[model samples]
Target: MAELNINGNRRMLIGKVVSDKADKTIVVLVETLVKHPLYKKYIRRRTKFMAHDPANDCKIGDKVQIVEFRPLSRRKRWHLDKILEKAV
Candidate 1:
């Protein structure tokens, strides 16, 4: 049913898979640049996201895209959308 699906924009992120030790799940590290309000210098900030990887296809250092999803576990709130690139 239409009601079963989310109807609004969802947060999507692109990051590199850092860990895949947990079955069907992955830890992705996303990095972003932010400019300091005062110093006006760009700084790198990184965040770790727990994402569902139903296929267990991701590997460390692989770039992937993920979409926000309803919480599947205590901390997993994102699901793998696609693998952008494989780690060499």
Candidate 2:
């Protein structure tokens, strides 16, 4: 898990915004590498998270930091904390 705990146990993650077409919402893609138990090979894993972007300040390909928060919708459990890098 690439979750960073800070500010009293809140989980934060750094990811890239893959989709920002939804109103007040953005889809972030997080990648992680895991070692295989038997082969001892690193495997890439990707996860998509639906984060709440109330300001709609994110765009596709933008690097962002999202923090875990109380569920505001059926699929939204993360809130947009900040933009780490904007897509050029």
Candidate 3:
């Protein structure tokens, strides 16, 4: 829900960096609250996204912003926009 706009209509998402072991790639975990159809209760849903990190400046637990972009690999469709906060 903290999405931002940059470079036109591409989608943007905010998430936490869960993995940064890959050479120039980072795995971001985006979580959202979804309401159940019948239960009317909110459920935490998580999605992992492979994002391109050209500078490899991210680390695990870092909050980062990512924007949708052309696929760089079979699974990489997002690029690092900026780091929101650094992990302590």
Candidate 4:
């Protein structure tokens, strides 16, 4: 199985839940700030991750932590670790 690093530690990411309509699955929008190589200006980049949420505890707008894992589905390679902040 593909692992995050040589240390066998899974990669962790923080993101906000964008969708939770699927059963036991939640879509998270992880945003990162990247600096342009030539311009040196930071720009916002966003990626959507299909994460497994066995408990179905996440709701839209909730901030959560996800950990990389073995493939749970065709596009799901991450699992919800914790709900960092409840939707408010």
- State the displacement of the C-alpha of residue 46, model 3, in Å, after optimal TM-score superposition: 0.3
Weakest ten-residue segment in model 3 by summed lDDT: 1-10
Off by over 4 Å in 2: 1-3
Give TM-scores for every candidate, taking all chains together and pairing residue i with residue i.
0.90, 0.92, 0.91, 0.90
Q: How accurate is candidate 4 locally (lDDT)?
A: 0.87
Root-mean-square deviation of each candidate, in angstroms? 6.5, 1.8, 1.9, 4.5
**What C-alpha lDDT, on a 0 to 100 scale, does residue 82 get in candidate 1?**
91
Q: How accurate is candidate 2 locally (lDDT)?
A: 0.91
For model 4, the superposed segments whose C-alpha errors exceed 4 Å read 1-8
Instruction: List candidate 3 stretches off by more than 4 Å.
Output: 1-7
lDDT of each residue in 26-73, candidate 2, tens digit only: 999998888999999999899999999999999999999999999999
| Model 3 TM-score relative to the real fold | 0.91
Among all windows of ten consecutive residues in candidate 2, which has the lowest summed lDDT?
Answer: 1-10
Runs in model 1 with CA error above 4 Å? 1-8
**TM-score of structure candidate 1:** 0.90
